[model samples]
Target: MAATESLPVTGGRRLYVQLGITLVVLVAAGGMLAAHRATLDSGTDRLAAADGEWLLLACLAAVATWVCAAVAQQGAVAERLPAGRLVAAQFAACAANHLLPAGAGATVVNLRFLTRCGLSVRRSATALAVKAAVGGVVRCVLGVALLLASPGTVRLPARVPPALLVLVPVAVAAVVLAVALSARLRRAVGRGFADVREVHRSRARACALWGGSVAFALLHAGVVVAVVHALGLGLPTGRVVMAYLVASGAAALLPTPGGLGSLDAVLALALTAAGAPGPEAVSAVLGYRLLTGWLPMAPGLLVLALLSRRSAL
Candidate 1:
């Protein structure tokens, strides 16, 4: 009895310790963000004279992004998720994603949530893989379509880097080698493919999965469009949408948590190429990030903590 009781106590201490370390890391990241306050403010200032109504619309679009994400998550699994809890988990995952590299935190939260909601570990994992694969394909296809339509929005450099050409094949080969070398990985891939087929076997599931994903990307782009209109940016709406889809698809290649710096840079450059002034482009990106990333972060974190306390994390 003593040993068992002591085990829980020790486990509690470890959880707290881990939480403290997470807080420390978050604070460090916050400090780094603060260091760029001047740059952020300069961009934000450019929106001072913008229309309030447009900004409100942008906020609405941002809200829709979260809802769409939740819908997509629910669609990923055949089992129905409790509506309220599923949405809350998605919100929390958004916040958690910012804290860890390559969306690891979000993955952990979702995996735990799915398991708690009565999914086996493998099934839960398969749902995530299916969702990711489908979403990636949708985003890439949409991005390519947009890019092809508005080629001028993305300008290529005069000369391709020789190193990049070599690096691409090397990276591809390395990934293949890793998969070939690992039996577990090969099994996982096979299982994921089977899961994908299972998910698409249902017409309703297929619709929800694809529909939610398209809405997620489009609504996010709509937020940017709203910002452009709010700030009276002369950039064409179609090109702005194109630029966002293309840049975001490319930025997804980076492993940064939520694609923080890489996404910002890519978005800014894309917006500029699309013919918005540098300051205005930066301002629009800042506003977009403010709505999607910063504003909801605190509440998302709180929800995450509450869920964790309930052992639903």
Candidate 2:
């Protein structure tokens, strides 16, 4: 009886600790964002004069990104989930994703959400792996297609640093080393792959997974494009889309909370390299971040808290 009583208390303490750490990270990220706002505000006058219609469309695209993400998440699972709850969970997960590097926070939230919806922990994890893998492959496909269509837009700089060349292989090695070190983890991965095979056997599941992932990526690009249009930056739409894909792919190679500063800087540079004016590109990136990251942050955090209180996490 005593041991059983202590279990809940211990778990509660652990939860508190996790939340506290997340809150601290959030605070730090906020500070970093504030410090970086100098670049963002460089074109505040232009930003203020942005076309409202295009800005509104960008906001809609942001909303669509979340919806598409929810669909992608749902498609990854075999069991039917409560639609409203699933979407809300994804909304909250987006906020959680920003609190940790490398999408770890969002992974945790979705893992818990999937289990709550009905699945063993292994199954839930497998579903997430499938979703991530599919999303990644689709993104790469889109990026490559765009690159081939407009090679000049995404052309590598004249000199590639030796470090940038080795980064990817090194990251792959690290992941392989981590997985190889744990027998239990290997088994989990094997099981996850098996689940992926099982889920893909269903045509509806497969289509939903691919379609939602594609839509999610496209909507994100749409947000950037809308922001550019709003700011009257006259870069080609194809180049902007290509820039977004390349920058996003590069940002994913590094683990940062919501790809905050790194993403903003890379994206803005990519836009300018593709021929957008510096101030206009900066303004567009700022608007995109506002629509996708900052504005939704507070409500998403609130939803996260609500979900946690209800044990939906």
Candidate 3:
């Protein structure tokens, strides 16, 4: 009787600890954003005086892309999920991703949610792996294609080291290969490929899902480009796309919450390599972060809170 009585108390304490940790992380991220505020504000002011219509369009594109991404994940798990439940699972997953470390905790949370919704862990894991691979491959292909199509726009300076260009492809390929070879990875992904027969039956749907995912990624890149343009910088579309892809890929590897310092550094470096002035590029990147990262996080937090309340009730 005593043990049962203490269980809720212990669980409540654990929840408090988790909340404390979350607060600390948010505080740190807030500090980092505050440090960059002046630069972000200046860039915002610059962009405000430029093409407002494009910025609005970019915002809409981002929202559409986010929904498309959720749909792609749904398609990956279609065998195990109903459409409405899949949409809720994805939104809940997104909300957790905004709150957790490396976005991985969200995956665990998503898996649990899927189980509650009647999906097996193995099936959910396979679907997630496929979604990640498809999204990554599409992003890289688009990035490289953009760079190739307009070499002059994305060209590194003659004085810049050749190693940087070599690094991009090598790094991407290595990451993909490593994932393919892992034992644990094989178990998760092998099943998805084994479902190749089923996939073939729905080949057109699969293709459409993959295409939508790619389009969604492109829309995200467009948002970054619009943010830069709003800052009164005239960047070539191809170059902006290339820079966004590279920076986004690199940012995924960052340890900081939501890629804090790491994303800004990579974006600035990529932009500089692509012919933008260093200060201007850094400013633009900071401004983009404001709109894409911090602004969205607030609403995500609200979603998370509402979900938690509903769960508790």
For each candidate, C-alpha RMSD in Å?
A: 2.8, 3.6, 4.5
Candidate 2: clashing pairs of residues: none
Per-residue lDDT of candidate 3, residues 1-313 (tens digit): 9999999999898678656755664675567557767777766655657577777876776666657766676666554445554455555455456445566745765666556656778776766667777888888888777667776766565695789779989999997898788988676556778654454468665875687678778887888888777766787777878888888789887766566677779989988887788878877786566566666665655554444444420
* lDDT comparing candidate 1 with the true structure: 0.84
Candidate number with greatest TM-score:
1
Off by over 4 Å in 2: 1-40, 156-189
lDDT of each: 0.84, 0.85, 0.68
True-vs-predicted CA distance for residue 37, candidate 1, Å:
1.9
lDDT by residue (tens digit), candidate 2, 1-313: 9999999999999789768955875685577568767766776788789899998999999999888998898889888988887888988888777767888978998999999877989788888999999988988999888878878766667998999889979999999998999998899878877878887899998888999999999999999999998888788888899889878888787899888767888999999998998877888888988888777877887787777777777
Q: Which order, best to worst by lDDT?
A: 2, 1, 3
Write one digit per residue (lDDT tens) for candidate 1, span 201-254.
988888888999999999989999999999998788878888788777876788
Off by over 4 Å in 1: 3-22, 25-29, 147-178
Give the lowest summed-lDDT range of ten residues in model 3: 304-313
- Candidate 1: the clashing residue pairs are none
TM-scores of the models, in the given order? 0.88, 0.85, 0.76
**Poorest lDDT segment (10 consecutive residues) of candidate 1:** 21-30
How much does candidate 3 score in TM-score?
Answer: 0.76
